[model samples]
Each structure stands twice: as C-alpha cells, then as structure tokens.
Target: MEKTPLEDWIAYKIGIRPGSLSREAIEQYQLARIRQTVALAKEKSTFYREKLSGVNPIKIMDYVQFSKLPFTYPQDIKENPLRFVCVSPKDIDRIVTLQSSGTTGEPKRLFFTKEDQELTIDFFNHGMRNLVGPSDRVLILLPWQLPGSVGDLLRIGLKRLKACPLPYGIVQDPEAAIAAAVESGANAIVGIPTQVLGMARHRKGKELAGRIKSVLLSTDYVPQAICQVLKEQWGCKVFNHYGMTEMGLGGGVQCSDLLAYHLREADLYFEIVDPETGQLLPEGELGEIVFTTLTRQGMPLIRYRTGDVSRFIPENCPCGTILRSMEVVKQRISGKTILAETDFLITELDEVLFSINGILDYQSTLALTGGKDCLTIEVKTERKNKIDPVAMRQVLHTIPAIQQGLERGTLEVIVGESCEFMPISKGTAKRMILDTREQQQRPSGIQHS
Candidate 1:
C-alpha cells in the first residue's frame, strides 16, 4: 500500500515527530534530496536548466557558485513567468500568486502542484499541532485576503484539525469581525496584528475575552507591548509565526521568547550568509537567511534568498520543541521610500527607536504628507509619562536622507494610535517601514486625533 502524504512527510523529515532523525541525519537526507530536486529542475524546467546549463548540483558545494547561478528576484518571475514554471500547465493543480509588499517594484507569481499542496498541508498540520490542540476554534482575523493564496491553504489546515473556522478578513469591517468572534464562540484567533487589535475600537466584545484561548500572529512581527495587552485582555497566549510565500510557509514560532522565528529544518536546510559577501556566518551572527527546499516538486527553490535579517540562538526552546530560534535585529526595517529625490531607509528609522533606553514599546506608520515629496512619520508609544518628539527629531535630523526630506517640508511627525491599529487582528504584527509610508500615501489614509 502507498504511504499517505502525511505518513511520508513525517518519515522523510527529521525532528518534527517521533521516529524522526537528528540534525546530522537530516543533513545527509538533504544531500540526497537536493540532488534529486536539481536533476528534476534541470530535466523538466527550461528556466533553471538554461541558467544552470553548465552547473552541476553536486559541484555547487559552496556558496559562491551557488549564488552565482542566478538570484530569482520577484521581477524576473513577473517578466517571463514561464521561466520558473517547472511543469506543464496541465500538470499544475493550483496557482498561488502574490502581489508582494516588497520594497521594490511589482509582485511575483508562484505555483504549486497537487503534490506541493499535499506537502504544505502536511507541514502546516504538523507545525500547527505545536501551537494548538483539538479543542481550539480559530478566528482568521487578517484584514486583507489576496485571492487564491495563504487564506485558502490555512483553511485546508484548519479543516484537518477539525477546529471551527471563523472567517475574518477585509471583507468584514473591524466592527463586523468583533461581532463575528462574539457570535462564533471562537477560541483562538489567527492573522495579522493590525486587524485583530482593530476590533478593540468597537469596545463591546470585551465579553468575548475568555473564549479566545490563543492568538496565532503571522505575516509580521509582533511588538512586545502589543503582546502584553493581548494576553492581559484576552487571557490567552500569543504565538508569533513568521512565514513567506517564497519559503512554502515552513517556519518556526516565537511563543517562548520575544519576537522571533526559526527555520523549519526537518523539511529544509537553513543557512545564514553575509548578505553582501554570501559567506556563511556562525550562530549568533546576523546575516541574510538563505533556504533550500527539500520536498517541494511543483516549484522547488534552491539557495533562495529571503531578505529578512536575523541571527540564531543556540539553546533549545523552553517550549520543549528543540527547535532553533532566530530573532530579527539591528537591520533596516524600512526600505527606499524615496519621494522628491530623498530616500529614507526603513532600517535606520527602526534602529533609532529600538535602540532607545526609556521606550517600553512602540508602533510606527509612514506617510507622505502635503504632496508627492512630503513625508510624515506617525509613532505610538506605550510609555505614558515620558515621550518627546523633539528629541526624536534631533536624532532623525542627523541622518542626511531624513533631514532633506524634512527640510523640504516633506516630512511631518505625528504621535498617536495608527488609523489602522485596530484590535481585531491577531498578536504578531508585520511593520515593514515601507508599509507605513505606503498606507500614508493613500488618499483616504490615516485619520488623526
């Protein structure tokens, strides 16, 4: 009899469940798996074979040749999409494309075979088991849902869990979502940080408090203070999960520590390399995380570059999962949001606030003020007593990019809750520096106090 997909995945990968191999054994398994994937890509896919014409997968034993093969940027996929399609159109079972919130231009298209879908279901099923039990009712409170992507996959996983599914998204306004949660008797909430908290504006669902047992925050980083309020008000645990459309949604959680995510090793091999140099870095060192997917067939990625900057911690998780953890730190949280010849890097701004001594917690949104060139920053602080904008401006003025944007009357600073910072979303929040700026540029952008 053929082994079920779930059975095969558990047996194939190590450290995910019982009978799994150790990291050393998983490495050996990966070598064979990588070779198989490369051959499949070269034989069937023209895009990779042409780029990898003279390249041998085994000969790519080091990082230099590996990166030299070709970096698969989102634009490349958008331009000549068929380049990345590994199988025939008929062979494709489902197509999951995304308009990237990437700092750069255009969105990319991604595909999954019937097999790839099965594998994703298996991986998320195993991963979710760690975060939730059978008695949970999950409220997917993300504000936006891109058609034919993550929300559907999550629904598949939820079905397998036999947990009640509470559909929540941009379709439901914050007030509507709060009413849904109250009506559905949902025990756990899952989604972006903004939408979950957005519901707090309604102020009537405080009675739904004890029903929410846990909050699964994804697609962003959860600030520390936001998590505190979630636990205090909801009387539940906040589990932060980080995933990317490129990475097949296989990643770890930061429930035990502050905001952190770990790469799922059983199904893929994780490496940290110096972003500029591509040289592998040791643990506890910050670098660009690169991934090589093992079991994916419809669309397999080798040495894929995820732009996130993170460093790994060496100890075991206190949650007892034995999974290694990675934390985002000291990197550019924002991107080139250049308006009027001046570009403000998100990284510099985040480092400025995060490095401060007195700040307990914070959330920030970026906006373009007055005109195409004008920029405004809206920041919210949890500290009640001591918050100063002038001091913050002095620190910002030193940076040439920010100062020019300011001197031109293009930059404005406002302090208070974000117009979108509602209480209806989940725990962990995704606050890339560009998101704030992009939201501000909208015609009906944030409304201030």
Candidate 2:
C-alpha cells in the first residue's frame, strides 16, 4: 500500500519543508491558524462576535483551551445564516440552501467565496489521486448541473489532475448509467452507496464487472456490506469518502490501504467529543465529530458540532503517513429512533438487508398501525417474481431488534416487492428509515410505545 497523497499536499499547503511533517509541526500550525481564525471570526461575523465575546484569542493557545469554547450547532445556521458570513454579499461566490423536511422553518444557507471553493477543489484533486490517475476515465454519478455542486467541483479537480471525468449525474436510471460507463470505457466510478449497488446488481451489470477498476462512494453512509458486494462482484477497489455541505463538500477520503479516512487537516481542525456532555474524548473513543475551519475565509465556523459519529484511529496508519485517520462514519447521532423499546437505526437495517443476495434496494417505513409499531419494507430485486415475502420476513427476523420486537408483540413486520423502483432526483435526500408516527394520529385504543 502507498502512503496517502494528502500528507504531502497538506504539508505543502501549510508551508512545511519536505520531510518535516510531524505531529508537533501539525499541532503548532493548527494552533496558530486556530487563533487567526478566532480573531477573524470575532472581528467580522456578528454571530461569532457575540458567541466569542468573552474569550480572548490569545488565551486559547492550546487545544485544551480551544476545546472550552461554546459549540456552534446546525440550528444556528438554519436560524440566521447571514449572521455567520464574514465577507460581504458581493464577495460570496455561492450560496447553498438546504431545506428542512417541512416548510415551517428556515432552511440552512451556507455561503462560500471563490477562495473557499478553491480549497475544496484542491482537496478533491489530491484526495482523488488515491483511486484515479492521469488519463483515467471516471464516471461521476452525482449532481453536476449547478455551478458549485459537488460533482462540478469534482470535475474541475479531476481535470486539474489530468483525468477525464464523464459526468452522468445521479443514478436515476442504473441501466443508463452502466451503459454510459461502457460507452465511455470508464475505469473508475464515483457515486452514492446504494445507487451504485443497484447498478452492480442490474442485469447488464456483469458486462462492466471486470472492466471498471475502482469505485468511490460518497454523499451518504457507505455500508460495509455494500462495499463487500461491490468488491466481490466487480473485483475492484471500493473507497469511502466522508463529507457534507457544511464541510465545503470535501472533508476526508480513504487512501490505498482502504482502512480509514485521511482527513484534510490543513484546512480543518477535527475533534471527537461526547455528544451529550460536549466534553472532548481521548483518542480512539467513539464520539460526535466536531470541526473548526482553519483556513475558510468566507464563513469560518468555530467548533461546529457535526452530529456525526466517529473516532480518531489511535495507531499510526500502516501506509506511512503522519496525518491522523478517522474511522468510517457509519451512523449519525440523529439517525436513531426509539421503537418498541429498541433503538432502531437505519444502519442496523442496512447490515441485515444488504447482506442477503438478490436484494437490489429497499424502502423502509415505520408507523403505528392497529396499536402496534409496524415496519413496512418495499424491496426491489433483480428478478421481480423471485423474491418471496415469507423468506424476506425470515431474513429480517434475524436482526436482534426485530426479533425482540416480534417476541414482545409490540411490533409488526410486513414485507413486499416493488414492481418498479424509482431512483431519487439530483437534489433529493438519500434513503433512510422513515418514521411517520409523529405525523399519524393515534387511535383511541393505541398507547404510546
């Protein structure tokens, strides 16, 4: 395995001489940048000015002191995004508005300047080198029509790296995407997790199994089951990427070792803290992911709580890089729901459903029906007529939560097949367990679980 290219790229960006990249040097640079960012944020942004009014930047000389600052939450952005902008509107290059589920609340709006976007493009350029190289044709199955969308920025990054990008957008039609890959002779693919799995399980999927050399799954959670299936079917490498709209679309990516993520440390300072108490945890302990922008100029967020769950790897990477690594994020703190006295998570369902062969995709819905917590699963398979509902229920029962729920008679499970599966649109949200009990009115005899 080769060392991650991000090491050299980050070192160069921070002005560290060759062969001088160490934990101490990185920490010193981060401390200096953190103070600078604090000063900048306090001077320009109204939200940060009030939030950090009591603290002096010079006093926060160490990571321990920095961790004592108040956290910035997602709700802060949704409430009044403009208050966080450091630059004037004329200098803002792009504004990404993320709508909430209902129309009653304001959506989150993230502002970015040209330089801010350039930082993301630079990270993508070097991070992609782990899976793609010059002259390689890669299929991009993400949103690219917008000016500053992730796919569009990735295209620019690949072009800078001298690779050919075949922008196919999202995988609305798996067959069409596979055809595009075949037509372009694409050697690598970047896409969402389940959508790519659908492509690999398509009838014509076998055609490109041996031809495609690598895959990069992003924009959503990457299930290990999906990765195993992709590797088994295509005999290719599968890489996982962790990012969101708040992180400027590129945070970290896996190296050739494929063990954990090599974070973009030069641009951001990452921390793991107890989600409930907000206390920073020691290395190797699982906790919520917190990040502070070290180099962002447009809208620098200090100690932003990401709500994501992961931990820093305590051991140094075998690939020989000093840059820290984080475990692949498998679940979000907000993704879990209490149903039938069980903590139900979408990842739990993913582990059970995706492991079964012949399952292409599934849609799960949880609701209260007839005084019981009911779970309805609409499964899509390669062969429409082959999936047996009883067998599917049997497989679902293998999950400990489902088994306990069934045993207690507090839950009911229903399994069926979808004749046609409609893929999500470019701007739509990714798949997850839909809990509709809040919207549904309980009957007279039903009691809350």
Evaluated with lDDT, which candidate comes out highest?
2
TM-score of 2: 0.96
Give per-residue CA lDDT, model 1, range 1-449, as digits (tens).
21123323444554445545355565566676777777778887777788668878787564445545555444566776667777888878877556555445555667878887776666666566555656677777653265435666666677787766666765246567777877887888876654454443235546667878788767544544445556766887787765676667656555444345545665666677887877778888888777777777777777777766677877765444334567743343233456446655555665565434334234445554455343345543233434576776677677677677667765655544233332222222234553344555456665432
Which candidate gets the maximum TM-score versus the true structure?
2
Clashes of each: 25, 0
Off by over 4 Å in 2: 101-105, 423-430, 441-449
Q: Model 2: which residue pairs collide?
A: none
Model 1 quality (TM-score): 0.74
